[model samples]
Every structure is written in structure tokens, then in C-alpha cells.
Target: MSDKSAALFALTNSLQPVKRVWRQAATQIFANSGISMSLANLVVIVNRNAQGINQRDLAEEIGMNPGAMVRILDQGTEAEYLERRELSRDRRFKTICILPAGKKLADEIESSANKLRVQLMEDVSVEDIENATRVLRLLEARASNFLQEHIHEKK
Candidate 1:
């Protein structure tokens, strides 16, 4: 294989273990907080945009389907973690707001995530981490551009 292909292969192989560690950590953290990973992620998004976020917008931002978002919202409502309030001017439009309980849970999840992140990077130097992040961002941008071009070409 060419040097570039060999490097890509090694990078792809490395990502599997990294992804596995993150998934395991997230599952454990969410379980301890009495929430699913999906719910915990949704709560974090809602809490960040606490002012007023439309359910549809939240779903789009999190790359979730509208139907799934509604189900997750329903579960959150049942758990008293979030509420959907009707807009006074437009009753048909409802805004999602994270409750105090949701904020508390978000905080806990963030704390646990941060600790896990630190643990994962404990052996890596700051400079190495920064370099890796830069390289990853560049790769992500290139991949995104390629996908967009390919998608448009197919249409």
C-alpha cells in the first residue's frame, strides 16, 4: 500500500478502540445517572439551549428523527426532567425547556464525562492531543466536503 493508504489504515484501526472506550464510559455514566445515553445527550442539548428551543430544532441539532425526539421528550416529561410549553401567541408551537432536575443530571453527566476524558488522555501529552485534534478536524472537514459533493452528484 502507498504511505497515505497505510497511514489511513492505521488511523482507522486506532479509532475503533477509542470509540469503544468512549461508548463504554458513556454507557456506565448514563446508567449510574438513571438515564439512557440518548436521553442524557438530549437533556444536555436542551439544558444548553434552555431559553427556548423548538422540538423540531432540537431534533435537527442532535441529528435525531422528529418521531424519536418526540418519544424522548415524552420520556423526559414523564421523568420531570423537561416540559413543553405552548407559545402564548401560537398555541400550535411548543418550546422545550429543561427542568432543574434535568440541569442537575446534565451537570452530573458532564462531570463524569470530563473525568473520563481526562482519564483517557492521561498518558498523552498536551501537545500531542492538540496536534491530534487539529489533524482530526482537517480530516473531518475534508470528509464532509467529499460527502457533500458525492451526494449532490448522485441527485
Candidate 2:
């Protein structure tokens, strides 16, 4: 095989271990924090965007099934992690927003995650971190663009 093919294969192989480690760490943190991963993600999204965001739009952005999203929202409301209100423009649809409690939990968890990230990369140099961040951003942009193109091509 060519050098390019070999390098590509090596990069692909490297991603699996990184993904595995991240998943394990996240799962452990969530389990210990008494918060479900999806709930935590929802909190972050709502905290950033604020309450009264369209339920349908939120579900679509998160790639969640509408019914499943409704169930999650209902449970979150019961847990005092979120609130739902009917939109003035359309009474038929409800807007879901995260509560203060949820925001607190989300912020704490995100801080913990950041610390974990720092610990994980303790041995890596700042230069290495900068290069990695750039490479990852490029890869993400390319992937996002490819998906967009593929979607448009289908239409």
C-alpha cells in the first residue's frame, strides 16, 4: 500500500481507542453524578439557547425521535430539570426550557468533564494540543460539509 493509505489507516485505527476512552469516562461520570447522559446534554443545549425554544426544532437538532424527545421532556419536567409552556404563536406546540436546577447540574458536569480532559492530556504539550484541535476542527468541518452535500444531492 502507499504511504498515504498507510497513514489513513493508522489515523482511523487511532480514533477507536480515543472514542472508547471518552465514552467510558463520560459514562462513569454520569453514573456517579446521578444524571443521565441525554439529560445532561439536554441541559447544556437548553442552558445555551434558553427556554421557549421550539420542541420540534430542538428534537431535530439533536437527531432524536419526536416521541422519545417528548418522553424525555416529560421526565425532565417531573425531575424539575425543565419546564414546558405552550407557544403564544401556536398553542398546539409546546416549548421546553431547562430549569435553574438543571443549569446548575449541567455547569458542574461540564466543569468536571473539562478537568477530566485536562487530566487525560496531562502529558501532552500545549503545541500538541493546538495541532490536535486544528486537525479535529478541520475534520469536523469536512464531515459536516460532506453530510450537507449528501443531503442536498438526495433532494
Candidate 3:
């Protein structure tokens, strides 16, 4: 590989371990706190969509299959944390809304995440964090764009 390609390859390869490390750490943290990672992420996303988000949109936002999203919502519904409501005139569509219990849980998740963020970046310089974040976002956007442009084309 050329120097440029080699650097890109190395950087992308290095991110896999970083992703695994973070996932492992997060799984442990969620376990210790008596929470499931999937549930936490799902609830947080629903909470963020304060106005209300329908099932299909919520599924897409979480990159979850609509069927799987229904299962997750079933759990939430059983817990009385969140509920699906008929937010539109169409009886076929329902929007996910955070109940009081769900909001409380979301708040706890956010608190835990904030604590984790503090510990994770305790000694990192602000400028360094900004630079790293910018680079990662750029790389992500570029990769997504490349896939969008090529994935639909006939090889």
C-alpha cells in the first residue's frame, strides 16, 4: 500500500480495538448499574425525541429492525416506563413517548454517562479532544458518503 493508504488502513484498524474496549467497558458499567446497554441506548434516544417519534422513525434512528424495535418497546411497555400512543389521526401509527418512569431511568443513564465521560477524559487536553473528535467525525461522514454513493451502483 502507498504511505497514504497505509496510514488510513492503520487508523481504521486501530479503531476496531478502541470500539471493543469501549463496548466492554460500557457493558460492565451498565451491568454494575443494573441496566442493559440496549435498553439504555433505546430509552435515551426516545427521551431525546421529546416531541414524540413514531415506531418506524425510532427504529431507523437506533438502526434496529422494526420487528426488533417492537420487542424492545414491549419490554418498555411491560415495565410501564414507556408507552406507544396514537399521536396521529391515522389509527395505524403510534408514537413512542417516555413515561415518568422512563424519564427517570433516562436521567440516571445520562448521569452515569456523564460520570464515565469525566473519568475517561480526566487528563485529556481540550484541544486534543476537539481535534480527535473532528477527525473521527470527518472520517465517519466520508465513509458513509462513500458507501451511499457506491453501494447502489452495479459492480
lDDT of 1 by residue, 1-155 (tens): 99999998998788879877787877887785567777888888888896968988888888899887888889899998899999899998889999999989888888888898898789999999999999888987999899999999999
Better of 1 and 3 by lDDT: 1
Ranking by lDDT: 1, 3, 2
For each candidate, the alpha-carbon lDDT, in order, equals: 0.86, 0.80, 0.83
Candidates 2 and 3: which is better by lDDT?
A: 3
Off by over 4 Å in 2: 13-17, 60-63
- What TM-score number comes out for model 2? 0.78
- 108: Cα error in model 1, Å: 1.0
Model 1 reaches what TM-score against the true structure? 0.80
Residue 77 lDDT, candidate 1, scale 0-100: 91
Question: How much is 20 displaced in model 1, in angstroms?
Answer: 3.6
lDDT score of residue 22 within candidate 3: 78
Error (Å) of candidate 3 at residue 50 is 1.2
What value does the lDDT take at residue 33 in candidate 1? 57
When 1 and 2 are scored with TM-score, the better candidate is 1
* Per-residue error (Å), model 1, residue 43: 0.9
Expressed as tens digits, the lDDT of each residue in 34-92 for candidate 2 is: 76777776776777776457788878777798789887787678889789888889899
